[model samples]
Target: MLNRKIQPASYDINEINFITPTIHQFKNNIPLYIFEGGDEEIIKIDFLFDAGNYYSDKFLIPVITNAMLREGAGDYNSEQIAEILEFYGASVRLTTNRDIAIAGLTFLSKHYEKILPVFEKIIKEPNFPEKELKIELNNRKQDFLIENKKTRFVAQKKFLELLFGKTHPYGNYAELSDFDEITNEQLKNFFKNNYNSKSCKIFIAGKFNSEVLKFIEKLFGDSLWGLNTEKNIIKFPIQSDINKIHTEKWDGSVQSSVRIGTLCFNRLHPDYYKFQFINVLLGGYFGSRLMKNIRENKGYTYGIYSSLVSFLNGGYFMIGSEIGSQYCNDAIDEIKKEIANLYMLDTNNDEIKMVKNYMIGQIMRSFDGMLNTSETYQTIIPYSLNEKYFY
Candidate 1:
């Protein structure tokens, strides 16, 4: 019997053991990282490619190419792909960002033999059918139009454009005309150039067997496919917008979205961890100073947050919120006051202890389970950092 009134003992977490992935190489030299642990007979496999927007000459080429990969590959159409995954109780997710593109699949470990071949075809022999390309582009254009209407979306987009200049790949945004202008030929060409064995890494997590590993190697590692050439590295200069302030007014709007930030250092910077700690104390959590000042004290907005966004090329520190139009000026003034207070006031040891405990708890949660630890590893893979980064 347990006493409901008595509290559990709390001890300082001095160390955490992380489940590191076992590294292997496919026949064609593709890297495979497997995190094997857990009781459930489920597994997640992620296919990472160096095919990202940085490699595209046009605005929508990389994203469109990524979408079309699973649309129609080999003899499987989009419907067939969906049907197969559904029949096996599996799921697939495709995503593209500025630095990398990923195709992730999750299913029962028993189903790996049936599903791996389907995904293999999707990655190796994508046939960018014109009809599927048009459908995807049209749907994306609709989403673009809808998102542009929201103040927060507009502010975020403009903020990136200001930080990285329009000419740089990170800053460039897609226009409506870009959707119409992008053709199947362009997507096909981009896919052929970037989605190759040479530019690929495979990550598998959860419970799987030795037979499963050999089967994966048989499917993906058997041969060099696509262009089979080394990735071409390209560099672009960062030309930041010189202006200190930028504003775009929207007619008949009841709210004003504010974004205050400047470019900062990447995760590899010596001060990265320290800067992240300070950010959480300021606005990264519910008990942060910004929330305490603006939301609880002034009743200005529901929530406000500050975050340090790190990218392959660069990073930035941003504070953002959408406040009532009438309170915008007062809210901005309050935000600046909070920033100044960080420097003017002395933080008590109690507050410091609280923050340290909060951050440590969050880190522990990230490594609580094998699947979670693997997902956390995904965040660091782009930076080429090892598990030691957590420590």
Candidate 2:
């Protein structure tokens, strides 16, 4: 039974400890990190690579190559692979961002042996068949067309291009012609160059034991797979303009979306933690200054927020919102005022304390379960960091 009327206690957290996993490296340079917890006989393995937008020599090639991996592989066609995964109650995901791409899979421990072969096919034997490649390209082209028509999408895409220059990998976007230009041969070449076993690490989380470990080692350990992929370096510099405002007109539009941001630092910078703390006070939360001023006080829009986004090469601070087209100027004015206020006025100790508490709670929410905990650790591995940083 729980108390209904009594006041809850107020407490402070002194330290946080994460149950970091045990690491086991395979014969091939693939490292498997195992987080052993949870009641159900399920395990999720995440394969992470430094292959993302920034790694591609051509626009959209890295992501397109990653997405096509599951379309056809080995002897199984797209539909057949889907049916097999579904029959085993397994799930597969392939996603990419500016910094990296991840291929994830989850299944019951009982079906581990049965499901392993299918994943092996996806990893080592992706065919990048022509029919499937064409279908994927056409569908993506349609999505791009639809997305470009949306005001928010236009604002976001234009913002990135402006921030990183039209030619930068992180800043550039694909044209419809670019999608049409992709060939199955290019996809095969890109996949071969990027998705090698040597470039990835495996994160396994859930109720797993010695037998499960043995099974993974037997299947993946002895095999000689993956291309020797070195970390990419851009010989040229990526540049961004300052104090830029871009306005794109969409006829018959009822609202205008706005993005205000500039190039900043990556997570590896020493300023990362303090900048994040300052960001929470500025606009990182619902109770942040931007939301309080722009949305609640002035009713400029239903929502407005800011973020200090971290990436592998660099990061940025963006303040975004969708408001009535007429009031877009007013909202921008108010946002500037809020920033000026932060600079002109003395720092508020109380605000910092409150934000600290709120961020602690947010961190707690992120690690609330076993799978989430494993995923949390998975994020840190790419940075060459470990659980010790958090502890």
Candidate 3:
């Protein structure tokens, strides 16, 4: 113990094993994954549904529908629901992304029974009251207006529209008119079709016992609910923009946001992880080539990043930064130069080793706690992959 000069032995990250949760099915065939481990009595439950934008035929319907679920439900109004959750020291989160929507609740295990019934009302019996819907839409419209003024927001939005055509579910964005045009009937219809018990998956993490399991089964799995409509398998072909380059000018802006990217493969592709490893060498981390060249060496901006983003239908490789308007051209040229360097020059062993160590640490961080491990598994569930993907 006193020999401080000698270093401790190190093991490869590949030697680490991820704990797989015990998978069970509720009576209605809803998948329940339980990861039970924690010193505290807190528990987290996530209900994932196929009710994302991909399933919506209209803009803003999926997200607005998901958000409005909590505004008013069965016997309780929004304020009553809020008061109940606060009294029980519970937190609720409802969000929709491109491919899925999630309703998450976190609270102490002692309050589980009391809070779950309220959640059930929110999930199954939302009324989509007109007054609440009007308020939510107006607030969201204001946020959209504010975000639309920023160069970064404009660049990001256009980037997606260009990467996948403006009509594709993953690429489409909302206009202000959408707020005025959307109807409650559409929200109800989308919710009825996509949030059915059959297509939902449940994930629970932290200290939970058999009683909690039984209660969940009794409430959510005892019988089929919602419209119980079979899910539609819809596919949209990628229709990327033909133009290689385009620009938009902001009247009174001193900074320019730059986004350069191309379409890539989804996580299901065999080479996804390998390409992600290479992407890290380029810009996936702080010590990456893009950071060293663009930020530290040239002082182009405070930071720059490259990512290999995975999605349900497809993925993309993007490099983004906000820089002084004057340096925009120079920065873009430098980025291309860096890519050329990667292609023309061989990476030295030292850089490769550093990146490898960084990624290993990242993988370890992703599974640092039981809840975090559960969250990591969530990313893979949509792809029908298992915990062994970590290996």
Judged by lDDT against the true structure, how good is candidate 3? Answer: 0.87
In candidate 1, which residue pairs get closer than 3 Å at backbone N, Cα or C atoms, i.e. clash? none
Count steric clashes of candidate 1: 0
For every candidate, C-alpha RMSD to the true structure in Å: 1.7, 1.9, 2.1
Model 2 misplaced regions, further than 4 Å = 1-3, 229-232, 247-251, 344-349
lDDT, candidate 3, 1-391, per-residue tens: 5798999888655577778889998888899999999899999999999888888756699999999988989999999999999999999989888888999899999998899999999989998988899999999999999999888888888988999888998888999799898778988888888888977999999998999999988999899988776676889877898753334447577778888888999889889988888899999999999999989998878889988988888888888888777788888899988988887658898998888889889888988877887888889998999977766
**Residues 129-178, candidate 2, lDDT per residue (tens digit)?**
88988888999999999998888888888888888887888787888789
TM-score of each: 0.95, 0.94, 0.95
Worst 10 contiguous positions by lDDT, candidate 1:
242-251
Q: Write the per-residue lDDT of candidate 1 for residues 144-225, one digit (tens) a residue.
A: 9999999998888788788888878787889888988988888878988888888888999989889999999888888887
Better of 2 and 3 by lDDT: 3
Roughly what TM-score does model 2 have, to 2 decimal places? 0.94
Residue 364 lDDT in model 1?
A: 85
After TM-score superposition, the amount by which residue 231's alpha carbon in candidate 3 deviates from its true location, in angstroms, is 2.3
lDDT of 1 at 75: 94
lDDT-superior candidate, 1 or 2: 1
